[model samples]
Target: MVQARIGERLGLAPATVSEGVKRLVTEGYVEIRGARDVELTEKGHLIAEALVRRHRLAERMLTDILGMAWHLCHEQAEDWEKVMTPEVEEAILAKLEGEPTCPHGNPIPGTSSGIPWSSLEPVAALDAGAGGVLTRLLEDVELDHDVLKFLEEHGLMPGSHLTVMDTAPDGTILLEVQRAGTNPARVALGRNLADNLWVLPAL
Candidate 1:
C-alpha cells in the first residue's frame, strides 16, 4: 500500500499518516518498497496475521453465538481483537470449531490454507440473467453499518443465490435474490454497492 492510499482509506491527514508510517518504519514493522509503496516485514506480517485472525474469529463468535447482526459484528470485533488474550482466542476458536470466514465472508487469516472462492466478480459486472452465489461483501461495504443492515435484511449475505434482473441507465443493478422461505424478490443496488458485492458464478 502507498502512504497516500493508507491515509485516504483511514481518513487520516497526510501529515498524520506520514508520521505514523515513519514510526512504523523505524520500529521495523513496515518497509518502504517502490517509490511510494509500503510492505509489511515478516515480523509485521505475523502480528497482522494474528490481529486479523482474532478479529475474524471474534466476528464469528459475535454473529453465530451472541446472535449479533452481521453488519454490526465488525465494529465490536475490532475491540475484541485488541483485548483478547491467547487463551481467550483459543477458547473462542474451540467454540467456533475453526470457522473459516467472517460474517461478511472474508477469510480469517491462519484458519485455512486455500482461498474460499475463485474467479469472483462484482455483482455490478454481471449481465442480465447471469447469476451466482454471493461470496463476499468487500471490506468497504462491510464498514457501512446501514448498508450492511440493508443487505442482511434483504438476504444478500454470502452463499445466497442472486441473479441480475436488469441495469438502470444510472448504473443501478436490479437483482433477484432467493431469500429463505420466500419467493425470489427484486432489489435494486446502486453502482457502488453492487461493485462491492462479489459473486462466484454458478456452474
Candidate 2:
C-alpha cells in the first residue's frame, strides 16, 4: 500500500507515515520509487513477518484464551502485540497447541503448518453452484474494521462453509453461508468484498 492509504488506515498524517517510511528506507528495510511507491526489502520482510507472527498469535490468544469475539480480536491484538515478549509468545503458542491460523485463518508466519495457501483462490473466482471452505481473510481486507465486522456478522468468517448460489454481472454474489451451530443464511457480497476473500475448494 502507498503512504497515503497507510496513513488513512493507521489514522496517521501522511507526513508522519512518510517520515516513518523514510527511516525504514534509510535503515535498509524498504525501497521507494517515484513519489509514492514503497516496497519492503528482504530485511524488512523478515522483521515484518516476525511482527505479524506475534500479532496473529496475540489475536489467537484473545479469541481462544480470553474468549474475545472473533471480530474483536484484530484491534485488540494490535495493542496486545506491543506488550508481547518472546516468552509470552511461546506461552501463547503452547496454549493454542500449534493451531496455525488466526481466527480469520491467516497463517501465523513461523509455523510449518501444511496449509495449501497457493491452492486457495479468491471467492470472486468461484462460479454459481460452486462452493468451498472460507479459508482466509487477506491482510489488506483485515485492515478495514467495518468490513471485518461485516464479514464476521454475516458468517463469512474462516472455517464457514460457503456455497455460491448466484453471481450478478456487476460482481455481487449471493451465497449460502453455513457456519457451525448456526442455520444457513444467504448473504449478499459486493464485488470488492468478494474479491478480497479466499476460499479452499472442495476436492
TM-scores, each model vs. reference = 0.92, 0.89
- For model 2, residues 1-203, the per-residue Cα lDDT tens digits are 68988898788998899899999999999999777888999999998888888899999898999998888898889887777888999999888775568888877878875367788988899999889999988777777888888888899888899999999988899999999999999999998889888899977
In model 1, pairs of residues that clash are none
Task: Give the per-residue lDDT of model 1 (tens digit) for 124-169.
Answer: 9999999998888888986677888899888999878999999999
Deviating ranges (above 4 Å) for candidate 2: 1-5, 33-36
- Model 1 misses residue 67 by how many Å? 0.8
**Clashes per candidate, residues 3 or more apart or on different chains:** 0, 0
For each candidate, the alpha-carbon lDDT, in order, equals 0.86, 0.87
